[model samples]
Target: MERFVLTDAQWARIEPHCLGKASDPGRSGRDNRLFLEAVLWIVRTGSPWRDLPSMFGNWSTAYRRFNDWRRADVFKRIFDAVSDEPDMEYAMVDATIVKVHRHGQGAKGGLKARP
Candidate 1:
């Protein structure tokens, strides 16, 4: 089977979960694939939103989408969904202290620090 730029299966997986109506509802045939791609591009390159390529359909649009998702807590939800469950049984490690450094705070003052 030929691969689509935006695979239908992947689109289906995320489509239902995406929130918000595209800004231009009158001409609202906005594609979520582009939005997702823009977000990925921003993250992968760590670039400013204004630097997004024109092919992503205006940097302002992508920025608006990014801000909307951020305000709506969508990214947090997605992160939680994809992350492994927290290790509740994880334990904190405490160790006996050993002096590794001999740095002195005015050693001539003859004051010893209390532990």
Candidate 2:
């Protein structure tokens, strides 16, 4: 499977928020960027952890790392860091569009008579 790529600028922005940096205590992560990409792949494709590609290493390890980061709120930190300056110039919402399910149309009898 094709993997995602982060430009130098993009990496620079998120690097500080990532876990297992050289400055972090304990054993450093093997490759934080690759690990993140693995997580992204699972999220984007909505695939189970068992389906993770071999290129990203063991699926169990990736899932464990994802859980560790999630429990630490690392993902929120990264989103906050990168979304500091969002471009809302073209943001929009279509309130006119609505979906009505078949069952929601109502039963044939508007009201049933009392027995």
The backbone clash count of each candidate, in order, is: 0, 0
| Candidate 2 weakest lDDT stretch, 10 residues | 93-102
lDDT of 2 by residue, 58-87 (tens): 999989889899999999999998889989
- Error of model 1, residue 80, in angstroms: 3.5
Model 1 TM-score, 2 decimals: 0.55
Every model's TM-score = 0.55, 0.79
Residue 3, model 2, lDDT? 43
What would the C-alpha RMSD of candidate 1 be, to one decimal place? 7.9
Stretches of model 2 off by over 4 angstroms after superposition: 1-3, 96-115
Model 2 Cα shift for residue 12 (angstroms) = 0.9
Q: Give every collision pair in model 2.
A: none
Q: Write the per-residue lDDT of candidate 1 for residues 21-83, one digit (tens) a residue.
A: 474333332766677777887888999998998878899878887887889687787666444
